[model samples]
Target: MDNLLDFFKAYDISLSQMIIVAIIFFVTIAMELSIRLFFRRYEKATQHSHTIKILFYLSLNKPLQLATMVIGFYFMAMHVLTWFRFTSFFDQVVTPGVELGLALCFFVLMNTFLSRLKTYSITKKTRTDGGYNNFAKIEQIHKLGQALTIAVMVFVIAAILGLKVAQGVAYLGGGLAIIALVFKDTISSVFGGLIIYLDSPYAVGDWIYTIDGTIQGTVEKISWRLTHIRTFDKRLIFTPNNLLITQAVVNASRMSNRRILQYIGLRYDDFDKFEAIQKDIYTYLGEHPDIDQNCLTLVNVVNGSTDMGSTTEGFFGGSSLNFQVYTFTKVTNWLKFQAIQDKIMMDIGRIIYRHDAEIAFTTMTLDISSEGAEPSPQAT
Candidate 1:
């Protein structure tokens, strides 16, 4: 022990300081292990309450362990630096860097905790007002916190290094316009994202259409700069957030029911049974399980497309009487509603067939008279 003391003394580390550092190292390890064991026991003890267990896991365990280790190391280094009288270099370089690193770690942990808490809370609530993810608001707050952290770190570092902050501020002021100009698009997009998050225009998994119908798809993701859309044809498009803000968007996902409107044409011969057909079809629509009972359901004859005063072109060749069917489905799902619609149409066709009626067809006929015709020379 005497020889070891002499060796350390010669190397400028007194035996007492060496012992203190060794003790700190071992104590840090012991503290970390203790924290882990404590959390484990606490978890077992509080297993009946999931929320409490989650709170403990999220808030206390990791942060406490990290803080214990970091504080121990920081104080240990300070003690050594003080003993060695390395104040100049320590104050200028090491102190600021360590403080910045600690601040960053704290903010990162805080951001993670808040994010997890938000996710848990939102998931438990059964009601949704507009969008699927409520986390976007939380994400905005986290980003703002990180930005403030960075700004504080910059000021702290400058003060530690003895730089004149006022002069730096002046310089930044001079270049502010250029910076703003360079980042105008990016800044606009960021604000646009914030507006989108706050306004709840649309959310991921929602089907939206631009008012002009140029863009229509399900929202896949919303990022800082762009919103991704996955179209029905399996194509993916990235649209700027600002453009979405400026344009009008219609969210079909918000609709409570799907509307079905159709026109069915029958041959002129079936005109006599039109009254029966309309009544029967209207009754069927009212009885259909998938059709919304509370909404308006109509079955009546409208002027056919071939009506003299109308200009709408008929898919059926020229002249045919048409009946209109308008109803709303109870469900908004496309596939399920399509199945219901198919069955209804087939039933309508069956009704027409049962009445000895046929669907209209386009036909043409021609006739000629040969009373005064000339013969060709080759016929002689």
Candidate 2:
């Protein structure tokens, strides 16, 4: 061992080099840690959230750290500055620079994404007063951002691997196209989700009823594959985004309340009680405290569209005398709507019965005789 030490000494492996290497070793560890510590200090000193503070500082310092690590290699190699030129300086930055950039980028992305996720988790619970369309859009935003980040990662990796940008894109373009075509439903769903998002449509918790005999329900979730809704019947419905985007949608929770315009037809024979019946119905709805008074609330004659084939227009004739009431109730929930409706209907039945009004129905009378037709009491 003594002889080996003498040999190393005689070979002119200077003690200075040993001391320098040692210093570099310690400093390298310090460099890695102190950089983190310094950022942490500033991050902790502020009123901002720890995550946000780190995020803000990271954005400014990531590239700077890469530059510093390149500088550290000089001290680590124990090389003299007179020999190292700009070309050598760049060379040192290359290996470490590539690694540092990707690491920093990924960290920033993850941290920011997590911060947004946390913010979403907390704030989404706050009453947006906006319908499920807006809420669904919130989730969609995060998902789209994640997808974009993933794509960026793919591009960056290809770039780092010395692949040309165009070549990388070309290599995947056809595959992506075929994949998109295969999963065309999913791609269409994203577009539909975006339509709902950008157009201020429904969110993930609104009670809605569609025209296609679909009843009202609470929107449960909006995903890339489907938008789920929980019906008041405790049933779950998965609607394709394409159906929602292209078809008609009614957002019941859009306003602070709901406006219900309904019709009740009475037989023309009981027309004598029309005035009194209208007054009673109007008074009851007016006195209801849960109804919004700010909107129009009086019953009036509403003309249907001019199309004779239309149900509304058809209802206009035959002495139907449709009385349209424009009123809004404070409740938008399905249960509350039903409860209010039941109360109103019960009251209406009582009033209609008291006035001896016959509610109209589609009935046909057949007359039968020996040769012709006459009504038969037995059939009744």
Candidate 3:
């Protein structure tokens, strides 16, 4: 050690300066090794914390490296300036540069930490509660958290650089109009996203139908600007948030009960048994386990209503009879709802057969007279 000190002294370097350099070098190496060992043990002990581990390593490594380099550079400059010709440039320019680097490193570290914490909290909540797994809500929270972090980091960095906050605010105010004009759509989308997060018209995994019939699908994800949907045909659609805000969305998955409204027509010959058929169908629907008992279930013959008999006045002279079947299923699942509907339809067909009724169809009869004879009116 003495020999090394003497050798540096020959080059006009102080023993204390050389000692500090060596200490910093060895300390950096030790820190690197310590970091590796700790991470290895931590990963082995808690593999479930893989996300946290990856975040920690990502947020830690670069900042530490940059900090080490900045410190070394600062001390080296100070020591070298003491021996050589010194100038105020080191104190004025170089010192501020080092401080800026350190401040940047700190900002990066904190930003990364906040991002990781946001992710970790979201993941933890998802594991605890199914509702917390709402992708739209979680995505909104993450975006807000990241925006706040960036804003804070900006202020902190400005302070470190000795820039006046008031001046920056004034400049921002001056440019507000231009910024607003340039990002009008983005601003609208951000507010739209906020509204969606708060109102929660639908969540991820929900089956949605737009009132305009332009979109119908399952919501797969919701980001800041767009909502992603997967259609039944396996096609993907990305809808802007602003458009969702303005349009009416029907959340099929959110319905408490699915309704089946049907009209069955029978031939005029079976009109006598129509009443019994309606009663039987109503009884079947009432006894169905999957049918919602609380909701209205109606099975009625159509004849004298203003629109029913009035519309049939021109055709068949109101002789046709139609039965209306209306009921709500207890389940909201699409596939199960379809199955229930199929079963109910089959049951109705069987009931009609048992009642000795035949299904109705539009028909017309024509009469042919010898070529020159007067044509008779058609019967429909």
- Could you say which candidate leads in TM-score? 1
Considering summed lDDT, which 10 consecutive residues are worst modelled in model 1? 126-135
Alpha-carbon RMSD, candidate 2: 10.1
Worst 10 residues of 2 by lDDT: 77-86
1-380 per-residue lDDT for model 1 (tens digits): 98976765665886687788889888988999999899889878865665824763655677677777777777677767866778786777667666656665565566556655555554664244332333445445545665676687678767756789999899888897687689988778877987887787777667888999888999888787898999999899998888899889998877888888877778877778878878888888888887888999988666435342344644333556676788998767677778888988899888888888877665445665667767769976
The total number of steric clashes, by the backbone 3 Å criterion, in model 1 comes to 0
lDDT for every model? 0.74, 0.65, 0.75
Displacement of residue 186 (Cα, Å) in model 2 is: 4.2
Better of 1 and 2 by TM-score: 1
In model 2, which regions exceed 4 Å deviation? Answer: 1-125, 128-133, 180-183, 214-216, 233-238, 259-284, 298-326, 335-380
The order by descending TM-score is: 1, 3, 2
TM-score of each: 0.69, 0.49, 0.62
* Candidate scoring better on lDDT of 1 and 3: 3
Candidate 2, pairs of clashing residues? 132-202, 132-203, 133-201, 133-202, 133-203, 136-203, 367-373, 367-374, 368-373, 368-374
Candidate 2's error at 21, in angstroms?
A: 17
